[model samples]
Target: MKIGLYFGSFNPIHIGHLVIANHLVEHSDLDQIWFVVTPHNPFKKKSSLLDNYQRLEMVYRATKDYPKLQPSDIEFNLPQPNYTINTLVYLQEKHPDYKFSLIMGEDNLKSFHKWKNYELILENHHIYVYPRLSKGHVETQFDNHKKIHHIDAPIMELSSTFIRSAIKAGKNIQPMLPQHVWEYLDEMNFYK
Candidate 1:
């Protein structure tokens, strides 16, 4: 089976995340997509992040109805300061029969070279990139472009930052997030 690892700090899983997962499953050859909720992303700041377990629960709630999309807290068990290479290696070892690839937005693709062991990752796995504002920049730099498949998935303007800000401003973030995720965040009074 081929699994696409949609790695992210799902502070509170939103509809945007679900849209990408659904698109990948429906349009691509991928068999499943695992929302690998990271405790800490090396490239991102930690101050804005919610608790890993809480974030994982939000992802779980968001993806519960989709059998092809799963919420995985795999990085939580790994060492702190989770790196994609480390997670990939561990996952490869654990599930020897299944193949894994990366599913990321074009914005992330631009700075992907700076990631730890990025060359090895590019060499070993296929990267499914969705078109964002940074697509042109990434396409220009990458010489071996065949490894990257640019997908025309729904472009979502909604982000975790927007969600957080909405909650902080006492605005309605219910529409920004999945129904169950919104319920969970409201119940916990998260981001307040």
Candidate 2:
């Protein structure tokens, strides 16, 4: 099966995430999208992230209805400062039968060069980059890569950082997150 790996911290899953996953499955030839919940993204700030299990559960709640969108806890067992190249290597070794591709935003594509073994990832796997704020920049730079694809994914300004701040200020996050995810966060007093 062809799997598109949508790796993120998922500090709390939201509608924007579901929209992109749906777009990828519906528009692309990918069989499914696995939400690889990262324990600690090398480029992101660790201070704001919730526990890996909690983040994974939120992703589960958000994507429960979509069979094509499944949550994966693969990185939870790996070492800290989760690197995409290592994770990809591990996944390839374990699931040799399945073809793995990357589903990342255009913003990330701009900084892809800084990632460890970036060339290996580009050579071995397909990268589906959804358009983001930095559209022109990302597209221009990615023109050199044959394995890269550009897709039209809605650019919602909503972010996990914004949601976390809202929750900390006792604001409602219903507009940003799925109802099931909101309920889960409420029950656990998450982001508080």
Candidate 2 lDDT trough over 10 residues, lowest sum: 133-142
**Candidate 2 Cα misplacement greater than 4 A, ranges:** 41-47, 135-140
Worst 10 residues of 1 by lDDT: 134-143
Which residue pairs clash within candidate 1?
none
- Candidate 1 local lDDT, residue 147: 81
Off by over 4 Å in 1: 41-47, 134-138
Residue range 75-118, candidate 1, lDDT tens digits: 88898776899999999999999989999988888788899999
- The estimated TM-scores of all candidates read 0.92, 0.91
RMSD of 1: 2.3
